[model samples]
Target: MTGFQNILTLYRENATTLLIVIVFIFTFSNNYICKILPLS
Candidate 1:
């Protein structure tokens, strides 16, 4: 239970950073991959 609580606390603290990272990855793949690769 303590370990689960710790994980939840860490997630709450870094939620914004996690969201930004996810968004950045999605954008990078969508824009760069489409532009560089032949298939889109």
Candidate 2:
């Protein structure tokens, strides 16, 4: 029981980190693409 709980906690932490990284990359690429294109 304790082992399962530990694994769950670890997974949650990793998921949060992954979500942050994904969001950062998405925002960075969006801005880069917008700047490259003349969308005014």
TM-score to true structure, per model = 0.53, 0.86
Estimate every model's Cα lDDT from 0 to 1. 0.91, 0.98
Steric clash pairs (candidate 2): none
For model 1 the local lDDT of residue 40 reads 44
TM-score of 2: 0.86
Best by lDDT: 2
Residue 25, candidate 2: how far off, in angstroms?
0.4
* Tens-digit lDDT track of model 1 for 1-40: 9999999999987997899999999998899888888864
The stretch of ten residues in a row with the least summed lDDT in candidate 2 is 31-40
Q: What lDDT score is found at residue 3 in candidate 1?
A: 100
Indicate the TM-score of model 1.
Answer: 0.53
Tell me the spans in candidate 2 whose CA falls farther than 4 Å from its real position: none
